[model samples]
Target chain A: MSTNTTTRRLTMAQAISEATAQEMARDPRVFVMGEDVGKYGGIFSATTGLLDQFGPERVMDTPISETGFMGAALGAAAEGLRPISELMFVDFFGVCFDQIYNHIAKNHYMSGGACRYPLVITTGIGGGYNDAAQHSQCLYSIFAHVPGLKVVVPSNAYDAKGLMTTAIRDDNPVVFLYHKGIMGLSWMSYFEGSTNEVPEEQYTIPFGQARVVREGSDVTIVTLSQMVQKSVLAADRLAAEGISAEVLDLRTLVPLDRAAVLKSVQRTGRLLVADEDYLSFGLSGEIAALVAENLDTLRLKAPVRRLAVPDVPIPFSRPLEQFAIPQVDNIVASVRGLMTFKLD
Target chain B: MEATAEQLRWMYEKMIEIRDYEETMSRVYLEAKLPPKIQKGLAFDIGAGPVPGEMHLAAGQEPVAVGVCAHLRRDDTVVGAHRPHHFAIAKDVDLNAMTAEMFGKATGLGRGKGGHMHLFDPAVKFSCSGIVGAGAPQACGAALAAKKLGTDAVAIAFFGEGAANQGAFHEALNLAALWRLPVVFVVEDNKYGISVEKSASTAIASNADRAVAYGMPGVLVERNDALAVFTAAGEAVARARRGDGPTLIEVKTDRYFGHFQGDPETYRPKGEAKELRQHDPIPALGAVLRARGLLDDAADAALRARVSGRVQAAYDFGRNSPYPEPQDALLHVFAE
Candidate 1:
């Protein structure tokens, strides 16, 4: 439950900042470091006032060296310190990759299992704004290659707080990627247990659990991060046609809650995976592979469908970008196509 | 000396052992007894840059590794650039395993995943990146770990003058200075990177001068002299141990052979290889010790003979050691 009034309207950035602030007060080691995390609060103002409250030592403004600072966080974590690093924009993770690929995720197993880098790196990924090729792209697949790294993507204010706390508490190094689109919104009174409610203390949500935002049986829709909202909108559109859909929000990708997915699939013989990132080699493909490998008693009425961004660089034009990314219309059409289409 | 003459004698043994090991290994490779490790699919990535070689040696620059490693513990990290045989030996890595690694057998350090140039054994503080200047910043991170964790550990980055010209080398130095990390940038200037002479790659007269730009103290040393290396390293190591931050050491020297095995001496000044061999660090140290009355001719001969025996023993072990199981190669590649 988040701290909000009955009629409070909060943006996604405000929700994330609230979650971070409450956690820092909960644990002394929860510090923030990024390009503009300090005096700038955050480029999106997600870390505003954290600097003045926590002081320079706790809230740091790191150099533009992503690899250096990212490695510093991993190194610090190996020695019994917890670091929460921020990449001003997710696209910049390219500048420093040895930190994640070689250092953070590999530290535990490479040290002959003597160490655990409990580090959480937060970033804003994907496109919507006019931030062009170099600045816009969801590069999650690159990280999923690492063995000991957890991937967390939050869709709503409640899930953001819950998933981020899970990442912080996780023993392995985790990457918490926040989508830029799920940001400014006034829908605070909708999500259950979030009556703009406030808890006086801190808490955490368990990792690898899928939250069912909407429950139905005609079809099962699996989505993550910002794509969850798009799928929900699509499901609402599908409801008018007398078709019910079950929407499962996979808050964490690494420790995927296969049980939730299997149950939804068993109830609804059809499945569609909608994701903001490209479809191939992405989380949806991995899940589909799992389903094919398992082949439980769940018989499908139609073949599974995957709706995602096409395998092209994010274009800058608003119309083209809109056509490029998978919106609710795409999800609705893809699910509808699977629900009644030929199985051949 | 309160440091114990026995410990000092052990130190002497380590340096002698490292020097003779390289000299004998060079001959072994030259004789082609050490089979080339490259298979059809796997190529030997010489260094971070594209320097090709079946085997490389620290050659005439033995004391730099011997002296710096003398002050380092087995748990500490020693990051070496391309061609890092000296650092591999000084930290007391098993010579047999290292030789087999050069042979690209299943018994290699990375189980054939890493060839001679990619040698790394974190258990004994030995690791090298094929990339030139890549290890410097990582070493700074490793040292920062030690400092933040409140440990006495330090990181040693062994690179060449060419690597000091790399942006990573500069960035690593600037960051290490800003953080006051416990690291030592040990630049082994063999006066050339592959074939491009230092005259062309770098403008700073010496590797140590680059340290001044990062707000750190830089020192130059006669790398061919082992005692000079030991005494100089003792000061830098002591300062690091005192939490006084990093030191940049530019060891001015030359190699006795070409950069790698099988190179025609087209790059070197005529007769320079033979002339430089006279300054081989082990013999140079022996001469200094003998002049100082610390060693006698008989002791020097015995030291050389003992080193030769050790080299023979390592060769025998490597020659007989079994290759890694065909599938065991995949064991450490991924974490369970």
Candidate 2:
């Protein structure tokens, strides 16, 4: 929004690293720690060049002890230090989730406002590059299901930088999740528009703000993270076919942009949610329920449709993996199907 | 590390206070469990008493608390496991507030949100968790904060021997040592983790033995002897304050009650808990005081009466306190 700011095309990983670097330089309390974050520069390149700039004390390389480091981060946060802890992959939350859900998330409420836990847990998510069930996952829904945590998933470099900066500054515990497929790493395949022009100066994007990527009126495609790219492609294709489809990228899951979602649904009268998480009792269901709760009030058109991974582990095989993931084809088909749905 | 006559008397009085408080809680909880058809004047109902929910009484583990807390400062932090009443009282948390919390009153430490297991009294830097092996790592964080803020405040984590097997426990020990954080990890080896003996669960003979793996001193003390525990914990607390990192102290004690109130406890040998009461630290320490000429029968009787009166006042305040409105449950879920 600032015309005076300089812009550069940075990858999602670079944007995240720069955001963390700027925040660290700006606030003395902010520090980064995780497995291989210091010397190795992070496996997904999220913390590249941070150690050299901030030194070893501020940018720490922890042991392969998830529960230890995660709990330590929460402990440090409660003591008035802003700790940005990386959990490597969102799939590894199981090893140290007790600290995240019970301690870190519940500290403020449990203390009766006497203690503040300013912590950010940044982790990589999404399945691609043949990472099996263990590594590839988009479990933002799980963290969002928790009450105390703020969940954010960035679809592009610009939003990634902005949201990461905001998460670092926020007082509450935040779960900053990134899709491995959209990090713009050269070794792994990435979507075409994953990397985008990001402002060089530090900026903050407030949570609960939904970005309307492409505006249309026939059907609104609600999605986030890696699925945002596929939704955009699906909307483009739908537009070429004379169908106006709107694409809404939910940047943060916890403080959901309910107004944006309801407004889009009211204008389109058709809803299609594309998610990478599980289909049953998950984000998709929550969105459908949100629409269902307001169906009697909103202008009626069609039942809400959801496109998500079936309830199963992500297979190692590429064919099976792609089949389980919500691809552009699936989004396109789901949107087209909803366009033809008839209301009773 | 020697306790003077004053310190000994203070420890004895504190231990008596804890004993009286826990005994009264047990009595009130059982009275609530009685069938309503008994038609007693007591307004006790099943699961609807002033002090409702799970109550883990620490009637026999007074030495461990009295020993460790005797060395701690108000600025220091202490985290406890499921059975935390002894730690809270030992750390000098407000008894009236703690009682109100146990009674689910708004004036409680956690404002009634956290019953006994999740009590959080930031005023004393005290917190407890029902989760096994969860407090050690948090204690490390508190120590780290103390170090970073240039304060000599140390942290103490009180856990059961059973929680020593948890990964969080191992991680906490390793992290505390690797960074040389000021923390004292105290394992109250009550010999039973909710009806399972320490031998039946953990492979290690003593939870303190695991401290060697983390390059720290491990001390095992006589759990029933308050003076022995006091001496050992004093050294550990001194070592931590001297920037010597953490020390694992295993206090071998016994639980006079079930893991939780009303627990069937069929897993333990019959009469073991009742039999273990003979070694209870309160009477043991009182005997020591008597031998030292620090306390006579009249002095002991007067101390017991005073402690009993204080505990009764706390219980009356809790019983007279009002339960939070149903909607208050949704409050305190997030801080504004």
Candidate 3:
């Protein structure tokens, strides 16, 4: 049934840049503004070749002031302009948090529906290379925790394009967190399909929808962003061990697709949450708590296990950072533990 | 620009209307603070009225709102500070809806979600923030839109002297000047931010002095005189319309009431608030009109009565408006 669908191979960076370009072409009100987004073609190349196509007006390069530019985006959104603001890194949310949290997130609510904030704050997240603590961290949950902002983290190039389109079209503020490791940059090594087959046509993947990447019955591994790739690798190892593992990719964290998760858990009877964010009070904990609340209905065979970064800043050293972040080996271990659980 | 008799009278009427509305808000807020009856074990009866939460009254500072907003059109925007009642009124935001919002009524601007501190009127392009200096950058955005859209519409940002110290404020000024956005940053120097005096907080004697660093005109107006404020705002608005970037105008104003209703105000000298009231711009505006022969004793009395009646009607509208269901809070957080 899917054989007729036409697609082309593209990297996650290409998919995102194409999505933004298409949106900007379609809507004059939609424009891209951020540090190094114009002449620099974006440091991650997510905005490469956009400046020449769209010109300096549409593809803007802001000063090194996140708060100033982000706040300007909020105002422009409020004034009926669709602004796609790029915060260079997710870790830099600290300086401009007031604009994002207090203003951008609350404008629609605080204005009593009088205002519609059509804003997309796209930022790079996750750490694989030695970018150190500041540059490498996936804090999607921090944005998801706040109300009024829709949080989306795409697993592959196909999902990246679709989700970016949806985020641009969304009237309320949407936080588009793309993992740097999954961008398929020449400088970075990523798994297959990190740059996958994507359709050229503009399309949208609705927020709060989860995709079952690899379906299985023995266990369900829930993860998102680059971790989706890692979880799939772990599932592969579990499959080799004669244990079926289902990998669920949560495309968006806020407006989370809890139904898809519960359905997977119901079938698998065991669940393992792998998150790249901080373990305590984060995506993993939230998922575990969610499943725990539905234990009676879902009828899990055992308690949900979580593999995430320990409660510490990402380390500078490669060994410490690797140990701190969740890895495929850790996911395999957690899934193995889940398979060995015996109900009393 | 010299103020004509008609224009002076109009400014006086706006100032008086704001004064009356703020005074009414103060009375209603004080009533909300009353203890509950013995039948209820609650210290304060939540059911007594729809009005709840803090009230930041802009009483003596009516001249700032009146003057700045007079230069703004419906399409032009104004982003205000926490003390936004006067600005909302002067910008011609629907008084009935604003009052209803203060009462937490369903008909309020935010459908009873945002109270006085966060009133938003899209028709007038008016919005305020509870956070200090948060509105400055936003105002620049609006001005950017106008500039991009090739419209002469300018944006005004209303903040306090204390907000001048905020990083957002400096960043906004720098950005506006850099981009040459049509925004006028109006700092209403009400002398106090909550309890912290401007002297203790800000190092600069005048917030306007910092405008030179951003390469924009800076002016200090006699805040108590509506004519003086109006003249200063006129020049800034013109400069912005002429694509001359932003201007910083510091209006040396005063707030007759505490930062919020029910504040003990122990930080102030015993008679400071009362003494400041002697320089209240509402009456000063009326005197200005009288001096110009635009208003007589009978006309002044008639204007005050009409303003009081309108304010009273707004209060009645608020009292009659329905409070939103608890579930309504969950709505409007996302777009439909």
Q: In lDDT terms, which candidate is top?
A: 3
True contacts kept of 1: 0.11
Listed in order, each prediction's TM-score against the native is 0.81, 0.96, 0.97
Answer with 2 or 3, whichever has the higher DockQ: 3
Tell me the deviation in Å of residue B197 in model 3: 1.6
DockQ score of candidate 1? 0.21
TM-score of chain A of each: 0.91, 0.99, 0.98
Model 3: per-residue Cα lDDT over B97-151, one tens digit each = 9999988899888888888889999988999999999999999899988987889
lDDT of 1 by residue, B109-223 (tens): 5655566766767577566666677778767766776775678888888998888877667778877888788888899888888888989888867878777888889989955
> Looking at model 2, how many pairs of residues clash?
0
Return the clash pairs for model 1, or none.
A3-A198, A4-A196, B47-B130, B48-B130, B48-B131, B106-B324
- The best candidate in terms of DockQ: 3
RMSD, one per candidate, in order: 5.4, 2.4, 2.0
Question: How would you encode candidate 3's per-residue C-alpha lDDT over A1-344 as one tens digit per residue?
Answer: 15667889998999999999999999999998899999888888789889999998888898888888899999999889999999999999999999999999998998788899999999999997878889898999999999989999998999999999999999989999999899988888877758889988888899989999999999899999999999888888888999899999999998899999999998989989989999999999998988988888877787789888888888889898889988999999888887777875
Comparing 1 and 2 by TM-score, which wins? 2
- In candidate 3, stretches whose alpha carbon ends up further than 4 angstroms from where it belongs are A1-6, B35-50
